[model samples]
Target: MMKQIEIRYATDADAVSLSKLIQRTILASNSKDYSHESLDLLCSIYGPEQVAERIKNEHILLCFEGVNPIGAAGLRGDYLRSVFVEPFHQGQGLGKLLVGEIEEIARQKSVSCLMVHSSITARRFYRALGFNVVKYQSSPEGPTILMSKSLS
Candidate 1:
C-alpha cells in the first residue's frame, strides 16, 4: 500500500513540529551551501515561537505523508517563504507539490506575481519552477537569489 499524502494550511498547534522539520532540513540540505554560522542564524529564525507567529500571519502549508509532516512552505503577501522538505525525501516531488500549491493560493488572491529569496542551495530548484532571477542579495544569514514568477 502507498502512503497517503496530504497538504493543508498549518495552525498554531503545528508550530513545534514545523520548527523541527525546517531546522532539520536546513541543517541537512542547506549546510552544503551555507556556513555553520549561516545555518545557525537561519535555524534561529524558525524556532517554534517564531513559526507560531508566522502561522498566525502568513499562509503556511504543511505536507504530510500519513501523519508525518514531510514538507512545508509559506506565502506572505506576494512572497514565497520557508519552503523545505525532509532531506531523505528530496527528489520525490514534494517540494514541487508544495510550491505548486503556493502558486495556486497566490492566484486565488489575485496576486500577479510571486517572489522568493531563494537560498543558494535552492536557486536551481526555483529556476526549474520558472522563477527568473531578479538579483543576488547578501544577508547576515548568507547570500540569496531573489527570484520572481508571474502568475499571469
Candidate 2:
C-alpha cells in the first residue's frame, strides 16, 4: 500500500531533516539536470549552518509519511527557493500539494507575487501551474529560468 503523507510548517527542529531531504533528493534525481559540481555545491548549501539561517529567515514546509521525510519546500519572501520530493515519491501529486501549500501561506501573508529560479526539469511544471518564464539565464551551474506568477 502507498504510504499516507502529511504537510506541515517546518519548525527549528526540522532543519536537519529538511536538509537531508534536499540533499538526498537532489543527489538521487536532479543530477541529470545539473552538473556534479553544481549538485555538490547545492548539497553543501544545506549544511546545518545554512539550514539554520534559512529556517530563521524563510518559511519552510516539510513533507512526511509518518516519521519519514519525503519532500520539502522553502519560501523566502516572494521567492520559492527550493522544492524537492524523493524520487520514489514523485508523480504522486505531492509536488503540486506542496506548491499549493506555499501559495496558501503566501495568500495569508498578502504576498501578491511569486517567483522561482526554475530547474530545467521543473520549468514545465511551473508553467502548467500558471507561472510564465520572464527570462532565461545561464549560470555556471547550468541553465535556469526566472519564472513568476501573479497571485492576484
Candidate 3:
C-alpha cells in the first residue's frame, strides 16, 4: 500500500528539507538527460537562497510522508515556481498533488492566470496539469518551455 502523505504550507524552517528534495529530485529525475555538472549548476542557481525567498513571498507547500519530506512545490504570486518530488516517491501522484495545491494557492490569491518556466524534462507534467505551451527556447539553464494556464 502507498504510505500516507501530508500536504502542508511550508515555512522558512522547512527550506532545508525542501532544498534537499529539490536536489534529490533533480539528480534522479534528469540523470538520463543532464550531466552532473549541469545539474549542480542548476541547483546552485535555484537552491536555498531562492527557496528562502519563496518561503518569504510565495505560497510554499511541503509534502511529507510522516516527518520525512517526500515532495515540494510553491507559487510566486501567479507563477508556479517549484515542483519537485523525491525519486523514490515519483510516479505516485505526488507531483499532481503538489500542482493542485499550488493552483489552489493561486486561486486564493485571486490569480486569474498562472505561469511557469518549466524545464524541458518537466514540460509533460505541466502539460498534464493543463498548462498550455506558449513557446520554447534555449536558455543558460538549457531548453525551456514557457507555459501558462488560465484560471478564470
TM-score, one value per model: 0.97, 0.91, 0.91
lDDT of 1 by residue, 1-152 (tens): 32788899999899999999999999999999999999999999999999999999999989998777899999999999989999988888889999999999999999999999999999999999999999999999999999999999
Q: Which pairs in model 3 have colliding backbones?
A: none
lDDT (CA) per prediction: 0.94, 0.84, 0.83
In terms of TM-score, the best-performing candidate is 1
The alpha-carbon deviation from the true structure for residue 97 of candidate 3, after best TM-score superposition, in angstroms, is: 1.1
Model 3 C-alpha lDDT versus the unseen true structure: 0.83
Q: Distance (Å) between predicted and true CA of 58, model 3?
A: 1.5
Worst 10 residues of 3 by lDDT: 30-39
lDDT of 3 by residue, 1-86 (tens): 67788888888888787887888888878766667777888788668887777789877788889897888788887788878888
Model 2 score (lDDT): 0.84
- Flag the better candidate by TM-score, 1 or 2: 1
- TM-score, model 3 to reference: 0.91
lDDT of 2 by residue, 98-151 (tens): 888898888788879999999887888899888999999887667899999999
In model 1, where is the ten-residue run with the lowest total lDDT?
A: 1-10
